[model samples]
Target: MPNSTSILSPIDVERIRKEFPILHQQVNGRDLVYFDNAATSQKPAYVIQALTDYYQGYNANIHRGIHTLAERATKAYEATRLTAQQFINAASEQEIIFTRGVTESINLVASSYGRAFLREGDEIILSGLEHHSNIVPWQMVAAEKKAILKIIPVTDEGELDLDGYKKLLTSKTKIIAVNHASNSLGTINPVKEIIQLAHQLGAVVLIDGAQAGAHLPIDVQKMDCDFYCLSSHKMYGPTGTGILYGKKELLEKMPPYQGGGEMIKEVTFEKTTYNDLPYKFEAGTPNIADVIAFKFAMDFITELGKENIAAHEHDLLLYATQQILKLPAVKLVGTATQKVSVLSFRVEGIHHFDIGQMLDARGIAVRTGHHCTQPLMDRYGIEGTVRASFSVYNTKAEIDQLIEGLERIINFMK
Candidate 1:
């Protein structure tokens, strides 16, 4: 059963702001307006405390030792798998595999699943809006396996061309990888439709949910995706820990991603056997402290309710976009009908890096440049964009400050 809870209005913005202690500070003698959430969200106090408590209390290497601390660490670490399973509404906890982040998660699939199943002449379809993490791994595997890479073209509005995507699907298309939300553009792709179409062509699909995990409702079972990737840091958890959710049957078929201590069942001079299910992909000591703290991050979202969070962030997006678009010499880069709370744009004749620096001087934090989507930037015929992404704790006041800063920058530059 799905983890059902009463939908509450996204926490009172004032109270939510207090939860994030970092938001209370001033930068450059001005209040900090953090707009770099699409890069990595600021962690709440609870998440921070969880990390501290783990290290100060039950810090130990997990799964191998028979000591009490080791047992406690193992239980706490594995509990995060359950939380992630529920967070994404996956069918089973066995599907969650911890990794460094979304990049490693995608690479795991490309190296293990791609190497095991993909062959020469097989085609892998990707969207034009993919982050480098999603694009490069497939390129490496496709090149090595002699498979072909095809892209679902993006429309002028920064959306996947579904018509073109349909035309690209063929019997030889074995895999389809795309982001649930474009980190650079904040365009939320219709992943369910994308997955369903790929399945019809007998192609396995992977959805990179790095940007969507905290802002959108993700039900992997509902989407029926073969693989799903997430970054905990992007979702208010610590860095260096995330999840890769693969369907049980597909995960069983894929080979281990790396060889290390915990992933082995039995090893000798002659032969070695691998661990089962999730552990097979999660090798080494693992990010135990952050993984434990990640559960708190998931709980943070669950308590607030995704619907409420999305509604609040959507308001910020609308308000910010309206205000920013009204400014002189500013043109929005992405105008997708559906998007997260991201506003990506370019100012006429103003270098994005300069705009970013000016914004920072005023204590505003926004991401500028290709945002790890260089190919997507090339598609738009631009070098990069100034991206302001909103999170649950952000308020309309912050957007107002951003607009004021941008207006000043635009006027001065003009």
Candidate 2:
């Protein structure tokens, strides 16, 4: 067992746990142990309340109406954008563009920026550890433009090959796209160093921050990344909402992602002029209600302090890692020195899907399969692994339940 003193401090964890009503439930006649946070974090009551209050109290379409409800709605929606700006430390509110999720955000960049700038033989670099959302959009752009797609290799421990990454960078390199943390394996990539190197080569960098928004600190200005993407669902907010952060200069240069009601400043049958920054990319009626509620989620993290939440999750990761490693039939994957509380592993002779189902039977939730990183699994010579991810509301006792369940499963399989 990890030293409790070093691994954990109260940090008012019990009170924090109570804030998430979903954690107080039962599954399969046992207390629920939610270890699948990497998929989407459970919403806290405050965030839920915000959603309810919006629908009941002030539900209205924003930006065009002069009515009181519309003005209030617009104010609340844009306030969340400002909150998102502060959350990621972007230089200005104009840098943030709302989207359905990280997938849409990346596709927006791949379409708008790549179509505008990339040419034949120009290279866009990605990593072996990327989710399918990050990989597929770039592939589409690369194929359309005849641009070359290069990969930064993944090591056995799931860390990116930085030396290899340096080798891949050249004058022809136009973009470098990588995740801040791997959703499947939880490896925190050295995005700052990656950005600096890409800039030196005159290539733009995009950090897919879907996993990091909830667990790590982000400062796009300090990191000097050209583009960054975040998912509200992963960060304890509502589903179907996220943001894309781009440097103002880059955004201004790129073409509009979609043509619709709001993104246009002036329109004619022959010609249309697009709106200003942020609005240029947000084409349709935005996810107003969810966007408004997302502020409460960001506030929840800000008030709790990311560092404090990280320490708590780190404790859970260390404890879980230590306990899992002691199982004779089990083998851990992605042993990166730095990670956010995700543990992926496999037991000998037991399929990952079977393990997930068995754990679910015991009222412990976990994710299994490729986790949308099929290439990473291939790199490890496996089909997939059982992944148990942690959040702020998770406890050491929950981890203990997972361990007890896993041990029984392993014994039974033997």
Candidate 3:
């Protein structure tokens, strides 16, 4: 067992766990051990209740209606935008644009900003650890504009090769799109340094913060990124709601992502004008209730504090990695020096699918696959891995069970 002192100070664990109600549950006659947090975290009661309260009490369309219900809903929904701005330490509420999730947010930038700015022979640089959402959109834009897409290679330890990244940047580079932390490997990229380097080369930077949202401290102003994307579901909020934070000047300059109501200032038969900043990107009716519910998730995190949460989870990662690495037949996939709570590994002489099935039968949930990072998997010369990711609610006792489970599977297979 991991030393409790090293894992989390006792008070911190108790206080953090109390906020997440779903942490107390049973599955298959056993206490639930949720290690699949990287996919989507289980929502706290406060977040769920917020969603219910909004619909039950004040369910109405926002921005256009003058009715009392609409006014209430509008205030609630817009309140989330303000909360999100503070969540990421963005410059203003106008810079925070709501979208479906990280996928839609990235697509918005690729289609709207890429279309408006990119021309032939321009270059877009991406790291090897990007999720498919980040990669495909750029590929689409590159093909459309005849722009070049360059990849930054990954080291054997699953960390970005910063030297290789430096070589890829050039005067013609239009955008540098990379993830803040790799979903598959849990490798935390040096985004501040990456952004600084990209900016020196005259490239705008967009960071995919899907994996980093709940785990890391995000300050868009401090990071100096041109754009940042985050998903609400990954942060203990609703599934369909997410945010995109862009610099005010850049958002003002970019064309509207989608054409519809709420995004226009004025429309005439001959000419139409776009609304300022955020509305220009949020075209039609958004997932309003989810957006409203997302405020609770943000509040939950804020109350507990991101630094404290990260410290607790960091202990879980260290404990899990130490235990898993001691297994003779186990081969860890990502060994980056800096990482989140993801523990991705492959067992010798057994397929990852088999390992996952056996673990699931023991009432332990984990994600097993390329994890939407096919290019990263290909680069590492592996088909997939079994990923056991951690969250703040997880305990050292759970990590011990996971280690014991893996040991049994390896011995049985042998």
Per-model root-mean-square deviation over C-alphas: 2.1, 3.2, 3.3
What TM-score would every model get versus the actual structure? 0.98, 0.97, 0.96
Q: Once superposed on the true structure, which residue ranges of model 1 sit more than 4 Å away at CA?
A: 1-5, 8-10
lDDT of each: 0.93, 0.93, 0.91
TM-score of 1: 0.98
The list of candidate 2 runs beyond 4 A from truth reads: 1-10
**Candidate 1 residue-wise lDDT, 299-331, digit = tens:** 988888899889999999999988888988889
lDDT of 2 by residue, 316-390 (tens): 999999988998889999999999889999999999999999999999999999999999999999999999999
Lowest summed-lDDT stretch of 10 residues in model 1? 1-10
Better of 2 and 3 by TM-score: 2
